[model samples]
Target: MTQMTRALMTAIGATLDLGCDAIPSPGPGEVLIRVAVCGVCHSDVHIVDGDWGAPPMMPLIPGHEVVGEVIGLGAGVTAPAIGTTVGVAWNGGACGHCRACLEGEETICAQSEGTGYSRPGGYADHIVARAAFVVVLPRDIDAARFAPVLCAGVTTYRGLKRAALKPGAHVAIIGCGGLGQMAVQYCRAMGFRPIAVDLDPGKLELATRLGAVATVQADETDVPQKLRDIAGEAGLRAAVVVAPAPSAFTQAIAAISPGGAVIFIALPAKTRDYLPISISDMANHEKRLIGSNVGTRVDLLEAVELALTAGILADIETLPLQNANEALDRLRQGRVPGRLVLTMA
Candidate 1:
């Protein structure tokens, strides 16, 4: 067995610690990947900082947006032959027989396992992932550029799909950070006009460069009015809130068209998770607040296809794997405008 270097979270609210360990062989229905790059997600910061519950295990390796090459396959696995490039996402694995799985909605599987959470993740030099869960990626693209697509890309794509909007409709991408920027590009690729909302002018500018039709500053008064004005008579068909702020949710629910949906993907800290919504307005207006988890395997496939054909890619900054702690710090500080990817090479 080859020794692999990994970053480990010893406890909640602790900076990750670097360590060396032997790479384990894949078991049945698994594949061993030589990890090339892994995106540093804000959720990693949330997990490390205990914004969510305790990690399923201590000394957790926090990464899910992983891209790598398959170097070995477990027994009974042969399709994704050795040397194939693959990407692992937030969805690590799920029970095959659950009702959600049968309904082709494995993202909602009650017994779903999360990468970098319930199992060993991609913050290491190597990873062993469930064979059925890894998406085979194009060998042409730089692995670093594809890392965030495994999470942020699929996430926002699925969110938009849930909106059920028509082409030329307006969609608000709240936050305008890494995920929000991707949301903007996806909206354009999916044929909907994207309206970017954020407090940071820099991010809003970047969103425009990435194809946002309009930009709104979140801190301005009458933000909903501004959104309505920009969206015109059609109004915003949906708002994808990728920001972890409860205020963003409040604003999104208020800004979208009366019958429009507000898709929630961000997970704030447990203490700040509660939101007060008017049940009467929701009922009368038929507004919907929908929760989109990471995404299904099919959603990932579509996202990858859109990225390849429509030229949608993340704005990424790369760092050496040893600098994992620094990457997490930047994400935690909200200092990164786009995704930060940690490279093992």
Candidate 2:
């Protein structure tokens, strides 16, 4: 393999510039991967626009949904052998000795490194990743299809898992965008009835094909009522708000049944981050509000397995690696109806 690699790099408030870098050998407990494909997430656009603030490093290669083949291994790494296909998500690595890590909750570990943020990521032909954090992937499926599973798939899966809803429970997936589409499939695969809510009728129609039992055209003021009507007497068991709009949160918080939970999975811009809630209502209804970061290594594995076994897949459109900037532009402008993946091959 060549010792140099091509990548799309950008600093905060700058555009992505195609550049080259010497592919560094993996350090201990790390692996060098030849990237097969990388999913362009909305977060990547946010990073480039400085919406999430300056990244820990400048000229960042922003991508968390990465799928690739292991080409080299550092010392003390043996399980994911050379040539094995693997996937890397946003939670790059965590300090094993932290209290959260000991409880198998590495996603919340204080010392966790975020892929594409705290560390160099997969927006390149080659990437170096912590071996312990890469999830081994099946070779049979098209690798490009699995890229978004590393982020959009696992993020929604983990968020819904945290709700602890029973089988046949009714869960409302607010926003029928990329992440919301994936969440709809997962809800069905996990044995729950999903109610898809979106302002776009086209997205709602696609969500219906993906397994949402019900679809609601989101009217800002009527969303909660529509969900309540669809959920019937049992009520909306839980609501996973994947839209980064405050109005979405307000609707979700009001739609869920008493004692149900609201799982927040989207990160909005700093300017619109605050949400005013009724404290008394929450206390009286016993509604739970929880924040879910990306999932741990274990959760990623389960999410992949469920996706493969249950025929859950992201609705995606592929673009060449060099068109990354175009992909980000589409996402930023809401022109993409589903996830966009950039293929290196």
Candidate 3:
């Protein structure tokens, strides 16, 4: 086996060099994985453009939705076999002793290490990951197809799970992008009446194909009123805002019926500290607004299983790792019709 691993490095703004190499060795409780497919996420753009918190060590490797096979295990790592297929998600590892980790919410751990942002992520041909943070993939699913579930699918899945909706409840999904598409499928599988809202008619059409019961184009006048009409008649239970538009939150708040919850899953390019909804509205209507980040390890596993069971696979355009820059450009320009994934040979 070759000792050197080839990786794509973001040397600076929008520039990637393909010659970077790393010889990674797993430490105690960690493993080295030979990456098969790494799903490109919107978060990568934030990291590359320095829009997110801070750049992860300059010349960073960014890719978190990774599906690979364990090639070597570090000392004290006993769960995954050498050839076991696993996924490395956004949450690379967390300090198990933290209060959040202790409560089974390690995704919010203060010391949690993010896969691409905080550490060397999956853009490389191989990566070192904490064994505990990896989820073993099922043998029945194609590895490439399962890649996006690690982040996008799991994020939407966790949002719905947190919503705590009962069967037959009206659930609205705003934005039919990668995450919103997954949300529609999961909501349908969970027996919720899935309603999709988006400005793009193509995306709405895709959402319908993915099992959404209704579609609302944001360009329509009185869109929120239409959502409210639907929710009021059907008894709205919750809404998940997968769209990053700050204005969408206000529309979601208006559409949700009394006691309905709205979960914001997207991180906008810029932060808006406050929503347009007044405190009185929340209190009087008994409405709840919550924010969810990428999911936990357990959520990743469940997301994979749900995707496999419901055939809720992501519609992706696969590109070679060499074309990563092109893929990122397309994603940044909003030209990508679906998720873009990078494949490694």
Q: Of the candidates shown, which would achieve the greatest lDDT relative to the real structure? A: 1
Question: Better model by lDDT, 1 or 2?
Answer: 1
Candidate 1 weakest lDDT stretch, 10 residues? 138-147
**For candidate 2, lDDT tens digit of each residue in 206-294?**
99999999999887568889899999999999999999999889889999999999999988888899999999889999999988887
TM-score of each: 0.98, 0.97, 0.95
Candidate 1 Cα misplacement greater than 4 A, ranges = none
In order, what is each prediction's RMSD in angstroms?
A: 1.0, 1.2, 1.6
Clash totals for all candidate models:
0, 0, 0
Q: Write the per-residue lDDT of candidate 3 for residues 127-202, one digit (tens) a residue.
A: 8999999998875557666788888899999988888888998888999988888889899887898899998899
Q: Write the per-residue lDDT of candidate 1 for residues 126-181, one digit (tens) a residue.
A: 99999999998888777887788889999999999988889999998999998998
> Each model's C-alpha lDDT?
0.91, 0.89, 0.84
Q: TM-score of the candidate numbered 1?
A: 0.98
lDDT, candidate 2, residue 296?
91
- Report the candidate with higher lDDT, 1 versus 3: 1
**In candidate 3, where is summed lDDT lowest over 10 consecutive residues?**
3-12
Candidate 2 least-lDDT 10 residues: 1-10
Using lDDT, rank the candidates from best to worst. 1, 2, 3
